[model samples]
Target: MGSLRESLNRFNKQQEKCQSTLTSIAASAAGSKASNRTTTTPAPRAVPASTLSKSPVPAVKFSNDTERLQHINNVRKSPVGAQIKKVIDLLFESRQSFTAEQINEACYVDVKGNKAVFESLAKNPKVNYDGKRFSYKSKHNVRDQKELLKLIRTFPEGIAVADLKDAYPTVMDDLQALKAGRQIWLLSNFDSQEEIAYPNDPRVPIKVDDELKQLFRSIELPRDMLDIERDLQKNGMKPATNTAKRRVMAQNGNILNKPKQKKKKKTEISKRTKLTNAHLPELFRNLNG
Candidate 1:
C-alpha cells in the first residue's frame, strides 16, 4: 500500500509538470517575447494557430456592428463599393471574363474605398466567383458575329440598346455589321422610340414571277380576284402583295385580246388564176385599144 501511494504521488507530480510546460509553451507561441524567456523545463513541439493569423487576408471587422454599419455603409457607398463595383462594372461592361487579380490591378478607386470594396466582393452574391475569376450574370462578353447574332435571337421581342450597351459598348457597329451581312433587320419602334434589330425569319418570300407561273398552271379561266388570291395562298405560293395579283391579271388579259390572223379565201385555181398570173401580156393589148 505504501509503494502504491508513492508511485501514485510521483505520477501526479509528472502530470502537473506536463500541464505547466504546455501552458508555458502556448503562452510563448502566442507572444514574441516568450522565446527570450529562460526555462528549466522542456516543451513539447506541436503545430500552432499563430501562423494562420498573420496572412495578409482581406477582412471587415465589427465590434459594435450597429455602430460599425454606418461606417461600413459609408465605405460601401463612397468608393469601397464603387471600386469593387467598378471592377465588376467594367467586367460586366466589357462583357467578358475577368479575374479578381485583374480587377485589383485595374481599379481606379481611392485607396480607402478601393481597399474595402475589393476584399468585400468575395462574399457578394451579385458577383459570380469561379474560384479564380469574376463576372456579372446578365451581361456576357460577345467577341464575334456568330455570338452576337445568337444573343439577339435569344430575345424575341428585341434586346434594348441601352441594356446591350452595358454588355456591348459598341453595339451599333455590331448591329450594322450584322445588317450588312444580311443576317438581321433593324426596325424602328415608334411607340417606344427605340430602334431594334432581329435575325431573319426562316420563312422566305416567294418571287412574283414564280407566283404567276403557278397561278396560270392551276387555273384555265378567269377566277374572282379574292378566289385567285386564296387559291394562290392555298397552293403554298405567296404573291407578297395584293398588287401582284392585279399585275398578273392584266398580263393575262393582253394575251386573251390578241388580234387573230385572217385565213386566205379558198377558191378554185383555174383559167382565171392562170389569166391573172399572165395578166401583163393580155391586159397590155386591151389597154392599147
Candidate 2:
C-alpha cells in the first residue's frame, strides 16, 4: 500500500508539470500574436508642415489721411473701378467664387469694412452675389473661337478688348489664331494702345476702270514742301510752323549771324597780278581819257 501511494503522488506531480508547460507555450503564442498585430497595424500619416501655416497678408501704409483719401480716389478712378470691382474682376478671370473675407485676404485689399463698396458691387450688372459668396455674371459668355468670332461680327466698327474681359482665358489665343487666319483684325489705339477686335468683311470686288487708273497715275504729288507752303500762304492759308526744319537749320549753321564776304579793292588785285596786254589797253585808255 505504501508503494502504490508513492506511485500515485509521482504520477500527479508529472501531470501538473506537463500542464504548466502547455500553459506556458499557449501564453508565448498569444504574446507573439499580439506583437505581430501591433507591428502589422499602420501608424497615422504625418501632416505637411507647409499646410499648417497660413500665408502673410499684405499691408497698405499711408502717411496721412489726405494721402489715403487720394489713394482711394485713384482706386475708384481706375478702369477696373474700386477695390471691390478689382476683387470681382479677379474672381471673373480665375473662374472661381470667393467670399468677401477670402477675397480681401487673397487680393490684399480690405473691402469688408466698406459697406458702400459691397452694396455697389452687389448692385453691379456684371457681378452675381449668393448669400455667402460672390461670382462674376458674364455679359457675353464667349467660350471658344466660334463664339468670339460671332460676338466680334455683331459689332460693325470694332469691339473693345475691355468689353471681352468676361471671356474665357483662351480668348487671347483665339484672337491670335483668328488674326493669323485673316478672319479678324486686331487694331490698337494710337494713344492708349488698347486692343480692339474687328471682323474680316468680304465684300464684292470693285473693278477699277482703265480711265480711272490712268487718271490716278496722271496725278502728281508735290515734291517741294517750300512751294506748297508758298502756295498755301498765297491762298490766305497760314502755313504750320516747321519746328523740325528750324531745328535742322539751327544744327547745320547759325541762321541769325551770317558772315559777309570781304570785298577786295581794284588796287589790291593790281599788286598780285603781272602786267598783261589786256591791262596795258585799259591803262592807256584811262590815261587818254
**TM-scores, each model vs. reference:** 0.36, 0.38
lDDT (tens digit, per residue) of candidate 2 on 59-119: 9986667876676566645543557668877877888788888876676445566667777
The lDDT leader among the candidates is: 2
lDDT of each: 0.66, 0.78
Q: Which numbered prediction scores highest in TM-score against the true structure?
A: 2
Q: Model 2 Cα displacement at 178 (Å)? A: 0.6
Candidate 1: lDDT of 85?
67
Q: How many residue pairs clash in each candidate?
A: 2, 0
lDDT of 1 by residue, 5-98 (tens): 9999999999999999999998878775554554534787776889766878889885766755565455446645556666667766766666
* Model 1 alpha-carbon miss at residue 61, Å: 35
